[model samples]
Each structure stands twice: as structure tokens, then as C-alpha cells.
Target: MTIPNLENNRVKLSLLDLSNYTHLESIAQQKDLIYYSPSDISTPEALKAYVQTAVDGYYHKNTIPFIVFDKISKNYAGSTRYGLISWKDKVLHIGWTWIGYEFQGIGLNTNMKFLMLQYAFETLEFEKVEFRIDDRNQKSRKAVEKLGATLEGVLRSDKLMKDGYRRNTCCYGILKAEWPEVKEKLLAVIG
Candidate 1:
């Protein structure tokens, strides 16, 4: 798929597009942001490795990653990706998301997710869009819940995080049928 851009609201999805991993480097400098996810990647090398792996994975399929930025703040905020694409099946997953410490609880993530889900359902016409979180991540789980995605059950031992521990995945999604209402709720909350 072509890299997404703001015009399509699907701007270039890979860091490679934004100056060959420059975005990753920006994220590496944000020590305060990387800690938000349950994983503790405390060093520069660790952070670089984390982003490199994600870059490699996105290259493997219909997946794509994008760096989030704030024009007003004029700084990189975090990273988010869309992958596990099943175009024929009409499904997609959005995760690997993180925001800077200062940006958290400021409604930026909600607004970002709002734009993404809206693009997927309204712009791209996707039938279903999902958010998967580590089951133990209450903050993330609650965040998705607050956005109005319905809980779709959990997948046990789904995959190992970079820390080499197994993760129980919690799935949440908004169907095309539910998008109108969910979008309304998301806009209300984010706005």
C-alpha cells in the first residue's frame, strides 16, 4: 500500500519516509515517553533496537508505522502503527503506540486515534479496525475502552514482547456498523 499522508489522512507511514529513521531517533531521545508502555527500554541502544525491530516488521507486510508530531509544539510526540492487514477480510490492527510523558492525559492520543479510526472507517472504508493491548496494561486498555471500542476477548500467550516475556493480548474493535456511534463518541471526547 502507498504510504499514508495527511491529505489522505494516511501520511507516509514509515520512518524511512521521514528521512531514513530520523523519526526513530527522535523517539529514542524521548526517554520519558518510552516508559509509558509496560516495557522499560531505558537506553539509547535499547530504544534504537526497539524501533529497528518495528521498522523491520512493518516492511514484511501490509503494516506501516508513523511518527506522531505536534505542529503547535513543533516536536515529535510518539509512534503508532497500523498492520495485520486483511483487505479482503476487511480488518486491520492499530497498536505499537506511545506518547511523550508530557503529552499524555492531554487528549492528544485520543485526538490522534480519532483521526486514525475515522480515516480507516470513513476514508478507507475498512470494515473493522482493532486495538490490541497487553492485558496487564490497564492504562492502555482503559484508553481504548474510553474510545468506545468493544472488548472482543483475549488471546493468551499471543506473543513475546521485546523484554522476552509472554503477553496476553486484549482485543478491542469497532465494526463498520458501530463506527458511526463510536466516531461520534470519540469526537465528543477528543474535542
Candidate 2:
């Protein structure tokens, strides 16, 4: 899959690959930021392996991950991805999102989501884009809701977390028909 480089005024989202391993690893190691990350990226070797998994997923047509870059600060903010893509169903899932501790509470997450959502809805013409967050991650749930995605429900014991616990997944989604209003709301906040 050819994941195009996406950028807006505030942020740039580039495809995540092996070459980005070191840079992302450094960001992942910053001040407990990796706690919520799906992979154990605390060390360089572990981060390299994680990146390889994402790259392999891309080759297998299962996922397209991106490195989030802060344009104004000219720094790597974090990472996010479009996973579980279903071309036949015109649907996709967006998760595996992490913003370094320093970058949190700013509008970087909002801007990043806006760029991805716009591309998913307008460029890819997907009928639906989904977000699944660990039920315990209140911050992520709130962030996804702020983007105008409707919470569908929760999937209990959906997957095993890195901590060795079965996590309940909170599911949310934005449909194509709802994109216009969502886009407007996102733009309003981004402005």
C-alpha cells in the first residue's frame, strides 16, 4: 500500500518505516510515554522490532502507520496508524496512537487526527473509520470522542494487553455521511 505523506499547517504525517526506528525510539522513551503504547518500545532494539512489525503489516496490507511530526517545533511528536483496513468494505481502523508526554495537552493530537480523518474520508473515500481504545485509557477515549466519533460499545476481553491483562476495548466510529459535520467541528477547534 502506498501511504501518502500527509501534512497540514501544523503537523506532518509520514509513513513509518525501518528508517524511522531510531527517531521514534527516542520519542517513545521520553518520560513514561510508552506506558500506553501497544508495543514495548522502551529500548532501541525493541522499538526497532516494533517498527519492523508495522512495516511487515504494511507489506501484508493490514496496516499503514505514520510518524507524527510537529511542523512548527520541527520535532517528532509521536506516532499513529491506520490499521485493520478493509478495502472491500470501505472501512478502516485508526488506533495505535501515541503522543509524547511533552506534546500532550497541546492541539497536536487534534491536528493529527484531522489530517488523517480528512484523508480517510475524502481521499480514500472510506465508508467508515473506526477507533478502538483500551477501556482504561480515559484520555484516548475522550480525545476520540472530541473528534466527533460516536462510541458504539465496548468489546470485553478483546485483546491481551502488554501488562498481561485482558483489556476491554472501547469502540468508536465516524461514518462517511457524518464526515462533513465532523470535519467542520475539527476545523473549528484546529483554528
lDDT per prediction?
Answer: 0.71, 0.87
Superposed model 2: Cα runs more than 4 Å off: none
TM-score of each: 0.80, 0.95
Clashes of 2: 0
Q: Report each candidate's C-alpha RMSD, comma-separated, in the order given.
A: 3.5, 1.2
lDDT of 2: 0.87
Off by over 4 Å in 1: 7-20, 23-26, 29-61
Task: Give the lDDT of residue 19 in candidate 2.
Answer: 83
Q: What pairs collide in candidate 1?
A: 4-10, 4-11, 4-12, 5-10, 5-11, 6-9
- Write model 2 residue lDDT over 94-179, tens digit each, in one string: 98888788789899999999999999999999999999988888888899999999999999988876878888889999999999
Residue 89 shift from truth in candidate 1, angstroms: 0.9
Count of residue pairs whose backbone atoms collide, per candidate = 6, 0
Residue 43 in candidate 1 has what lDDT?
Answer: 65
